[model samples]
Target: MDERDHASLPEGTHELSSEVSERVRSVISAAEAAANAVRHEAEQSAQVRGRIAEEEAIRIVDEAKGEADAYLAERRRRISELSDTVVERAEKIVARLDRAEEVRRQLQGLADSLGESAEELAAQLRDQPPPSVPQAAEAAPPVEQAAVAEPEAPEAPPGEEPPTGESEPPGGPEVVQLAEAPAEAGPAEAQAGDDRHEADEQLSARLVALQMAVAGGNRGDVEVHLRETFGIEDPVAILDDVFGPGTDAEKRVAWPRTGDSAA
Candidate 1:
């Protein structure tokens, strides 16, 4: 071979090298594209998972909030109902006590009147004289005694006895009828108490409903409930007595009793 030929590359070597280089670049580009696609797919999957997790978290939060709201609402309802029941019972007790006081006053007046009447009757009895007893009539004189024969019953034979069939009645033994016992007063009083208890229960139920209405803070509902529960048409009347005429507003207000001095 010549020196130039020796120095030059073999036939088709450059072309082959170029073709191999192209094939290698194509393989590298394809691999790079596959890796990019895989990375993109991973990113997308991660985004989807993150979104699902966020949604799940939001759903859990919403559920918890709903449960909490329901619990709070139920708690408020129970508290309001309990408060109304207590107030109703207290008012009823106060009313009954007032009635008892009035009854006591009435009894005291009646006793006083009875005492005065008894005193007048006693004075009249003392002023009148006792009546005298009547005298007995004179006794008659006794007559002379005379002898009289005595009659005797006939005796029975030794082997026979007197017959008692004619002396005995034909019917059965006599039965005595007893009168019925008087009805007790206790049953009437118990019936009255039962009626009162049922009325109290009804009033308590109405009062609880009224309290729920008041909790809603509607002015019309408050007025209606107040009138139905307490027989007070004006809602302002409940608070109007706090500072009445001749009362000091600056004084202490948490008194133990109605007549207690706030100061």
Candidate 2:
């Protein structure tokens, strides 16, 4: 009821019934307790939700930190690999430079050796007399003469007997054994003739060499020929052996084949 209705009632004549007031109070108390229980339950639900949200936020933060650390590690490893690669490339370049320097040094040594050889040859040429020009009358190239081979005798008919009597034989030694042939020359004359023939051969060989040297039209021609003919390996060492001591004083240009080194 309204407050006005309660104010209009006389104090003693309008008192509420005890049983009704008791029932009303019990109902009000029960409703208040129920409302309190609902509020407490709502507060507990809000606290549980808050705790879950906080735990979830913490977990997300931890996950993000772990990912960040892994990414940094990966980047650091890649940087280290790049550094190693750069160092390796630099080392390779250095190695190549070193090899190039070594090759250049070897080339310089070769050049020096060639220069020394050329100097020696120049000295020898200065000391030695120039080769004489070949005469036009004897311009035909020298013909190397070998030992004259004896002619073989004609064979007799297959059935006929060979000439058994003293007859002029084919070879020089055989002819000397025959009675009809003149006796062989004395040892002294034969030796003199041999000496003359040897001297002529030497002169002929020297002239041919001179002709060849002139034909090539270069100072190195003779050196090349000497190396090829005598099998001299080192270009520098061959100079000493070719220009002997006191060789400049020699008048005759004798062809020397003492070691049989000539081709």
Candidate 3:
């Protein structure tokens, strides 16, 4: 064969050149294998990071669920406690109302008994005779004497005339006797005095009633009735001072029995 035909043929190449080409191809294959190893390592790293992030997300969701459950439990407990307190308060109020009703019934019964007793006593007293007119007239002499003694001058004193020489002493300090004129008590004043006297008599009668009640061993009940009937501010003190603690001398001085004319 010719040289050109042999050079184009696969069996006509140089043996040394073929060996060099094979060595160069082996170096290139090794470099390509190293690049493939680096790419696989990067892929493995990304997969590890994704797994870690998924685990962290799951843990966070679990923690949030636990916190929500705890909040709900606490709110339920508070609501239960408040409901129990309200029920207890309602029970206490009902109990108090029951006690108050009982007390009111007892007080009403006591007042009714006292009223019946007082009515019976008053009826019995009304059946008895009052003081005689002669006795009442006999009781008036001492009061008349007291009224006469209380006046500044005697009822029948004589009038004296002024002397002519009494005016000559005016240059010196004049002696002017300033005596208060007697009040002209018209029908209105007389009516007021009569009302005052009637009030005093009624008060005296009530004082006697209170004394009788105390002697019969019912002072507290009598005092309650007195307060209810008369609307008194201090029934006990008034009763004690008027009926029990007052002396005869103090009564005679403080509430002197005057004549009707003085009244």
Candidate 4:
């Protein structure tokens, strides 16, 4: 081989080397591009996961808030229902008390009528006519010689009982005036009048005391006391017909109105 041929590269060797170097550089650049694509895909996946987590957290918070609101609303509804029930019961109690008080007033009116009737009856009895007596027979001689004659007896008063068998004096019976009978009775009539007046005063005092005891208190409490004090089976029966009607005298001792009683 000539010196020039030895110094120079073989036929196509340089071209082959140049081709191999170029192919290696192309492979390195392709690998670097693939790595960059993989990194970009990872970044995209991370961003998508972060967004999903944020959405989930927001949804959980919204759900929790919604549940809390519902719970609060339920509690408020229950409270409102309970309040309404309490108010209804209270109103019923008050209505019952008002009705009881009204009944008590009616009873008091009836008691008044009874007192007046009793007074009128007493006055009628006082004005009645006196009873008639039997006239005496003529004076008898000796018991064995003369026959005993019986005198006819007069009719008795409507209210008075007839006397038993008894003989009158020889003179006819003297009729005394009804007005003068009390004078003849003397101290007895005066004492009887005084006793009746005292009884009336005592009765009036008892009624006044009972009225004061029941005043301003609850109707149920007053009714209970009335039943116990009056020996009544039913307190409300004071207004019934069994006790008779009220009179002007009893009506004057009526209970005051609720508002007036407090004052």
State TM-scores per candidate.
Answer: 0.38, 0.36, 0.36, 0.36
lDDT tens digits, residue span 1-263, model 2: 67797778777645555567888999999999999999999999999999999999999999999999999999999999999998998788666666656765665565455545544544444465533333423322221111134455689999998877467544444433442222233444556765664444333333333444323323255446545643435434333333432333222323322233212
RMSD of 1: 26.9
Deviation from native of the Cα of residue 243 in model 2, angstroms = 41
TM-score of 2: 0.36
The regions of model 1 sitting more than 4 angstroms off are 1-7, 102-263
Expressed as tens digits, the lDDT of each residue in 1-263 for candidate 4 is 46686459786876787799999999999998999999999999999999999999999999999999999999999999999998998788677667757987886665555545544544444464433332222112322132234445798899988876454544323222333454455556556766665454434333433443334333344445445543445544333222224422122233546554333
- The lDDT ranking, best first, is 4, 3, 2, 1
- What overall lDDT goes with each candidate model? 0.52, 0.54, 0.55, 0.56
lDDT of 3 by residue, 1-263 (tens): 68786587676366756788898898888888887888888888888888999999999999999999999999999999999998998777666666656765664566456545655554555464443222334444655565456535324446855444554444222111111111232445556765664454346336544444433424555556566554555654555554465433223212111232123
List runs of model 4 lying over 4 Å from the truth. Answer: 1-31, 103-205, 215-263
Which stretches of model 3 miss by more than 4 angstroms?
A: 1-24, 98-263
Give lDDT tens digits, candidate 1, residues 52-155.
Answer: 99999999999999999999999999999999998998788677666666765675565455545544554444454443222221111111111112233366
